[model samples]
Target: MILKTKKPVVLLFALLLSLVLVGCNKTAYINSNNISEPSELKEALTQQNTVIIDARSAEEYAKGHLKGSINLTAGELTINEPVKAMLAPQEQINKVLSSKGISNDSNIFIYDNSGGVYSSRVWWTLKLYGHENVKVINNGVNAILDNDFELSLDIPSIKETNYEAKEVNSSYIATIDDVKKAIDDEDTTIIDVRSRAEFDEGAIPTAILYPHTKNLYSDGAFKSTRDTYLNYNDLGLKKDQSIILYCKSSFRATQTALLLEEAGYTNVKIYDGAWLEWSTKDMPKADKKPSTPATSQDAS
Candidate 1:
């Protein structure tokens, strides 16, 4: 999502009306093969090495969750040391996954109560650490329940493993310096995926205001690849150009970044420090200050 050059404009805009009628289905996602239908989990839960992770609060996990799914909240995978809700270190990630009984070969499926905002962050975290076997459950817990899949109140016991995270996948991340360079880079686009109200309050200069909510359909499921590509391409983002995304932290950014890649955008990166770090620095900004300080709800 780029300025190097442009390609033939996608002609799928007219198909939106027909797509809206089919609702959410596995066939809808052609760009990324990382989505799982709720019904697919019925058999997935029975397979060895299959681990379903519920990326919600402990309280939410206690009330109900997909059967055999383990609970791993955002707090478990992130830190607030350098910035608000930055992703945890590789060592911490290894410990957390091992303690949760997630092995290197585990076929992991992650979900939240109903949306990708939280769960997708976890999915990106796994990918950053080289856990490519993971998939995010579309529509999450609500859809799984609606599909008549079983939920359990019983907390499963864990058999911890000796987990090791791979070398940091730098492609998914962008440092503050990288962002500074991109600010004036002719070929790069930095998107601020925060709310319109937040964007009005303050934002990095030149950052486009494309909220994370736009990534979902009215039903909270992700839009199809064609829809996502078409709608996002309206920003004149090229599939081959560079795109940088950020939100309050990078939770919301990861949500869009992953989808952008899924929609055939090859060069998407998340500014993990996001507005939190940028606001802290003496960098050039569009306004005086940000409106709201981040809350735990906004952090990933």
Candidate 2:
């Protein structure tokens, strides 16, 4: 009789190898070059056809912002989809970008006041929509002013461009079900990208604590690629393993996921609902401080 068991075992091994390769090939849309320094940006402005975007509230932008920069907040890029803060419809995104004179051919640079936090959100949105060239200025508006550059109160007249929307890249974002599967997958690594206090209070089971600030400098600039790699490498993360990132509401997770992806990680995904949906879904949550106060950090 034929040995049926041996053939089945060989098939299983082949399947596992194929899955690993797929994970390895899941590279992020952006890379390390997406991070720009103030001085370098100043020089680039002279040569490159660039569109600088200030990702802050309108009120904040009115106070003062970089000259020639357009104001585009996180709210404009998203809508109330199945979950709050989900990316907006393609038409909306295209309208916003085109109105701001942003085009697929332009080198887009984004920055925010609160560290690189809000800027990273805009970066994620653009990449999700398949805008090819985008970067977040290291530090932020302060980085520009600190270099003795000029700031303007006047809003520049925007000559709109035809910013088309490409196919949405769904691989960068993860769902609650995907997270549940990751929890059970031995090769998956779940990272908690919140503050130390927030992580100490409660987190997903088996998730590692890696604060988003750890990847940023006091000046708000992202650390060098070598430094960024070392920080995550300390956690014994492999370059090819699948990683799921989550924070209070998913903002910090997107920021942290970008850093990890820039540092050469092959597979990185953000849980858009993050802790908000995870806790509500009756999923496994571990609280290191079970007696902590009920009023914790805001999800946003």
**lDDT value for model 1:** 0.81
Best by lDDT: 1
Give Cα-based local distance difference scores for all models.
Answer: 0.81, 0.78
Candidate 1 C-alpha RMSD relative to the actual structure: 9.2
Error of 2 at 299 (Å): 27
Candidate 1 stretches with Cα past 4 Å from truth are 1-27, 30-32, 287-300
Clash pairs of candidate 1?
2-238
Per-candidate alpha-carbon RMSD to the true structure: 9.2, 14.5
For each candidate in turn, the TM-score is 0.86, 0.81
Report backbone clashes per prediction. Answer: 1, 1
Q: Model 2, residue 249: displacement in angstroms?
A: 2.2
Model 2 sits at a Cα RMSD from the real structure of: 14.5
Instruction: At residue 167, give the lDDT of candidate 2.
Output: 76
lDDT (C-alpha) at residue 226 in model 2: 59
- Candidate 1 accuracy as TM-score: 0.86
| Residue 4 C-alpha lDDT in model 2 | 70
Q: Which residue runs of candidate 2 sit more than 4 Å off their true CA positions? A: 1-32, 287-300
After the best TM-score superposition of candidate 2, give how far the Cα of residue 55 lies from its true spot, in angstroms. Answer: 0.7
